[model samples]
Target: MKAILAFAPLFARLKGAMLLTLLLSLVTLAAGIGLLGLSGWFLTAAALSTLGSVFNIFAPSAGVRGLSFIRILARYGEKLSGHDMTLRLLSDLRAWLFARLFPLVPLARRFGRGDLVSRLLADVEALDTLFLVALGPISTAVLAGAAMTVVLALLLPGAAVIYAVLFFSAVLLVPVGLVLASRRAGAEVVAAGAALRQAVLDGIDGHQDLVLFGARDAAVASSDTAARRLSAARRRLGRNAALAGAMVQILAGGALVGALLVGFVALEAQQIDGPLLAGLLLAIIASFEASAMLVRSATRLAGAAAAADRLQAIATSAPGIAEPAAALPVPPGGEIRLEAVRFGYDPAHPVIDALSLAIRSGECVAITGPSGAGKSTIAQLLLRLVDPDAGVVRLNGADLRDVAGAELRRRIALMTQDAPVFLDTVRANLRIGRDGADDAALWQVLEAVQLADFVKALPGQLDAIVGEAGRTLSAGQARRICLARTLLSEADVIVFDEPTGGLDFEAESAFLVELPALTRGRTAIVITHAVVPASFDRVLELRAGRIAERAHVPA
Candidate 1:
């Protein structure tokens, strides 16, 4: 499950016009150069043989222009087709990357800020080189080099032999060496860039905490270090690139000098005609420039691969829980049972272990424990966010894993203390629990949560645009709105984790008083550190990682 490159099959599946466009473009590029070389050879030969001849003058004039037109058409086709394919493929790559990422968020959020930031922005961007540019050029470079090698050998076997070696040196040898020299440096550079990206995310998210603690200056200093690290890595990698380029240039210059030396001797000895020597020499020079482009493309490959590796890592990580292929149908009752369950976010540190509990339909239970003593873990178990490492979680005797995902989640409504308020309208946030709810339906839930009056008094009422993370609302109001969202679900089972955490005495009182009505006929599990009034219900406490005790309400 940890092998990240498992998703390569998805990329290898792009079909239809995408592959065709890439092929057509590369063919056009190689063919255009070949035609241009032929035109030059023909024009030279005609003039040399027919000096002051009538047919020679007209043929060069008419035939050269016709060849020029054909070349321009191929060049145009190559550029357009290559560009079209790259753009479309870029879109497909981004979507696939995003889908791979979404399933990992709950697990990945456990990573440090630097790692997450880099994965989202820096790593994703690094892949631009692979999809948008290199794919086509790398293909064309190999194909064109092969065609040129054959033509040179046919023209003059000795000269072509020399050119073929140079082509291999430029296309393969030089680039491979450069990549080896720079590969580790390139990966380091990407890591540093991700660190810097994480620093930016932290600075923004912790802005209020930094201000309160008078640590703004310290935070900025940390960010500066991250930025410097990124810049230094880039500079070091750039040096490696410059060094590789220098080596390629030296090889290319020497090959061209060799061609000139060999070419002049052949002409002087009258082994090949002047026209044929000129044509072969020009072809060799053209191959050198193309190879230089190929080298630049190779250097970018290290950066691209570094990005792809991160994306692959996300695609292949294991999920916290795996659903079963089949299960017995769920019973009509919303009753749930946990038997000898043990679990942990980290194996070395168990959060809930050997915990056993049961809740009949229409029962309301309040779970209480010291902070970090697995109070929230019980609530999480009911929602099936994380399955117990050992033991069973069942709904009316049907194993949770066997039930369909949507069916399991739909009948249960949960509100966590750390739940983020989305950037949406007041109504929109409430509507998430019941998407097609009308105004009357929304008001009913608001009344149950004791927020009906406040919502009605708002200038925009249901249409009020809440700020990002519900910033425009006070803490208690935000919490109540979230509670209202839970109420609107009308689910068979409801689990509330510290729902009244931010509310004042007045708001808290109303919430506690009005909430029991909503839980009637539905199984409810409430997790809290605070004690509620002695109501007619069961109470459970957790210690270490297990359920410590269960008792009836003392009153």
Candidate 2:
């Protein structure tokens, strides 16, 4: 419940729309009760009236029609306002979650891809019904029940206490009991749903592997198990809700019976007429309409509560890195230095231990090493994705931690080994390097990467929408496209982690040969296992978590 309450601030932001929804719901429920009560009273009175008596049928009929119209209009408005607010809230939740999530990048280490996707889509969706079920219906039920009790109190005091007790018990006690009983099941349902989604995502992502390994049946079985778990959990939650609803019905019946008993005694004492008694009894039954709605929503409330807890966990988790409180400006020169830096998954087994290195501005340096030699860790350090446990990483003598991350990133662009080409136009993908870049610049970078001909031959040229992850493009083409994007960035420093990762031997040689001329004026650092060409200014080989050798080459 506390986790659910964590979203109170977001709810407050849309208070106006939510308030309107609640008001319309109250009006709708009230009008419904009044219509039922009046119809009963009007029919009975007309039946008991004399044949020639001045019975106002038109007045009662008009009142009934008016109440019906109000109910229809208010119900429509309630649904309209409620759904509008719901969509807006969902938008806000997604935006807020993304904003929180971006700062915590390298999320792969802590959260699985499928699990994060589930949180972003499924978990957020689970919270959309929070207000409609958890707040509005309960409020409507209480107010409607109170109004009916007051009417009973005035006309037949004997039944007032009976109605109030039974009504409150039905609305309040039953829902509370349902929530408590369904709490565990609701959490299970959410967990099972997330698991099912994860299973499906995993199967899709690994479908080719499954087919190649002849494990398709295993994957199908896994997905089936997840689906069955989700279904079973939902059944448990539904069962609890069904039982609670039955209890509410029993309470409603008891309230009606108690009212009848009191109404008879009051009629015997000449305190109430038969028609009036029928009207009050009918209104009492109608008032429980809100309670029925509340019971139905009570089950959803438990599910929503569980979802809120999951969302709150993500929202409240501390980011891996924190921005400096007072940021320093990046210096003009693109000199990068790592001094006695130490970092690793396990602190004792440092991947980069006491490793110190420095690169002057406008120099192109290539760092080469065997697999698991911590080549990529250096790239992460340069980008400040992870802070070192023991030393300082500086940009032009200013500590990387002293500058705003965004400012630092703008000055230093990195092309990671696994950089993805998103599902967008070729032009759109390149523009991410430098927004608003002209066509000539795009073509120049493409030409430098030897990809101009490939892109120009396409029907839409730069505007051609590529498939997701550049599936439409070959592996070498995708790698070059990413490399061109990095070359397009107007940064003082550009780091390429395996820039020619998927290229053939001939293409890789061509790219390496042109790397010097392409990044001639920037501080370029290339982390690769490829053969270092003579054109590079310097080369360093890493071994045993330290730079073991360095060689300088003349222009």
Cα TM-score per model: 0.73, 0.85
Off by over 4 Å in 2: 46-54, 207-232, 324-330, 368-371, 390-392, 417-431, 434-485, 500-515, 529-535, 538-555
Q: Which lDDT value does model 1 have at 375?
A: 84
lDDT of 2 by residue, 439-472 (tens): 9999999999889999999989999999999999
Highest lDDT against the true fold, candidate? 2
Which clashing pairs does model 1 show?
353-545
lDDT values, one for every candidate: 0.72, 0.88
Worst 10 residues of 2 by lDDT: 546-555
- lDDT per residue for candidate 1 within 173-274, as digits (tens), equals 776776677677677888877777778888999999999999999989988998898788778777876776777677767766776777788778887787
Q: Cα RMSDs of all predictions?
A: 5.8, 3.9
Candidate 1 local lDDT, residue 60: 53
Scored by TM-score, the top model is 2
The residue-level lDDT of candidate 2 at 202 comes to 85
